[model samples]
Target: MRRRLSEYGLFFRECLRNFHATGAIVPSGRFLASALARFVGNGPAGGQQILEVGPGTGAVTRRIVAQMGPDDQLDLVEPNDRFVEQLRQQFETDPALQRVAERVRVLHCPVEQLAHGKVYDLIISGLPLNNFSVADVQGILAALTGLLKPGGTLSFFEYIAVRRARALLSGRAERARLRGIGRAIGAVLDQHEIRREWIWPNLPPAWVHHVRL
Candidate 1:
């Protein structure tokens, strides 16, 4: 209980310090994390590789780690140094994470800047697309897509009706930016979306979009 509260405090501080990168007001709710980690598993012959981007303080990371098979490996890519430190500490102390600590690694970098040839069977993202420019979101999405193996799935979430709500209060420039982001996201969902999960119990409600190549 104390640990969870502390994690939330850290997340909240990160939000105030860097809302654009930290994204949400708090860590993802359990339901939303579960939906995002739904694809984490061992394949027919075992040994599935998973990648999680923007795993702030390991909210969704816990769910993903809980779902990982014996032979599964997870790489967490986080841009925030404090979040990365917290994640490392969790693996060192948290009982559940300790179980698969050997199979997990935390990378201190953005997904866009991660330079590696490794591809994953499943990729879950906690990035806030609505906070970025259209080009930035498109680039980030493209990079995530490129990191997946053939037929691999990518699960990411967007807050429900966030753009609309913000657009109502934002200036014309902000509204146009929001619309551009919507169009960029819509294009991907229209073509590659495999499933959608609506999680209403989250902070402000959210939709997890699962897509494939």
Candidate 2:
């Protein structure tokens, strides 16, 4: 309970400091985390390489750790210094995560800057796509798909009703930005969406998109 509350506090602070990057005011709910990590169990045999982008406070990170096999490897890309520190501590101190600590590497940089050519079997993104500009979203998406192996899976989420809600209150510029993001996301989904799940239990509700490349 205390740990959970502490995570929430950290999430709240980061959200305030980088709302566009942090995306959510709170850590992902268990239901949402489980849904996002669904592919972790269905991965191809032998072993799997996974990349998690924007892992704020290690909420989904913990869930992924729980689902990881002994041979699996996880690489976390988080630009926030505080969250990176917290994630390192989680692996160091959390009993459930300590066993797999050696399998995880926490990289403090944008996903786009990560070394290329190394492909992942699965990529789970916690980025708030809606908050970014169209060009940024496109570049990020390109980087994500680039990191994935052939037929690999990429999972990410966006809040439900966000576009409609923002459209109502946002000015012309903001509204146009949201629509541009939609088009960018749509282009990817139209081609590669294999599955999508709606999690109503999460704060403000959310939609998870599973794309294959």
Candidate 3:
């Protein structure tokens, strides 16, 4: 348990650093894990082919496996080498995860590079949109939408309050611009045929937007 806590601590610290560096905030593993569980349980049809982007430390990956049936497949897209290595090492020995392990395809690449023709049943993301430029966010959403099968769902969570608070505290023009960019991205997502839902149980709370295409 101590080791597990230490790993999570490291993950959280890395998440903070990434947030500062790229404006990409990662949800807490516990929160993401629980959300994935809930998503699977409430899925219209049981989760079969799932794809995850920015699975920083496999927090949601583990939960996805637990919630999915043995026949399900999970594809993880991660760009960080260290996190990818950690993912491989962490689940290398679990029996229940063995099938998911075999089925798991960890693409050591960015989401933008994922091939366009493939579609998934569900796509979950932990990328922070508050840090991206308008074009960047649009490109990402387009790429994600392209990867989803028609009628498939794409779910993502973000801590809008924290980002807005940070912007207010900074009191800078750049921060304000970023806030606008964030809103624009949200608007674009809303304009798409996606449904948005906010969940408060997450640390710092979050809004989970589900887009069914």
Candidate 4:
């Protein structure tokens, strides 16, 4: 209980310090995590490789660990030092994560910087695409698609109505940036989006997009 509280505190602090990068004020809720990890347990039991980007404090990471197969491998990419350390400790000490500790690697870098040699069957992302510039979002999406296997699935979520709401209150520059993000996402969705699930239980209800490449 105490550990979870401390993790939330740290996450909140990071949000204040780096709103664009940290994204959320708190870690993902259980329903959101489950939706993001929907593909984790569906593959062939033995040789699946999964990658999780921006796993802040391991909220979704716990759900992924719960669903992971004995021989499955997981790679976590997080640029925040505090989050990276917290995730490493969670895998070392948390019961759910410890069960699959040997198969987990917490990389201290952005997902775009992840090596190219290894591709994954499932990629779950907690990145805040709406907070990034158009080019950055495009690069991130390209990197994610590149890391996925031919038939691999990528699951990610964005707060519902965020762009519309932001546009209502933001200045012209912010509105234009949001439109660019929409264009980038639309381009990807036009090509590969397979399903979109809505989770109304989240703080700011979100939509989970599942894309297959």
Encode model 2's per-residue lDDT on 1-213: one tens digit a residue. 999999999999988988988888999999999989999956777779999999989889989999998789999999999999999999899898899999999999999899856899999999988888989999999999999999999999989979889889999999998899999999999999999999999997999999998
Q: How good is model 1 by TM-score?
A: 0.98
Candidate 2: 10-residue stretch with minimal lDDT: 38-47
TM-score of 3: 0.82
- Backbone clashes in model 3: 1
> Which of the two, 1 or 3, has more TM-score?
1
Tell me the lDDT of candidate 3: 0.71
State candidate 2's TM-score. 0.97
Assess each prediction's global lDDT (C-alpha) against the native. 0.93, 0.92, 0.71, 0.92
Model 2, position 4, has a per-residue lDDT of: 92
Q: In candidate 1, which residue pairs clash?
A: none
Off by over 4 Å in 1: none
Choose 2 or 3, whichever is better by lDDT: 2
Cα distance off (Å), candidate 4, residue 109: 0.4
lDDT score, candidate 1, position 14: 91
lDDT of 2 at 104: 95
In candidate 2, which residue ranges exceed 4 Å CA deviation? none
Summarize candidate 3's per-residue lDDT along 108-205 as a digit string, tens digits.
Answer: 88898999467888888877776676677778888988898877778877774766677767757768667776776667576663555566666667
Residue pairs in clash, model 3: 151-213
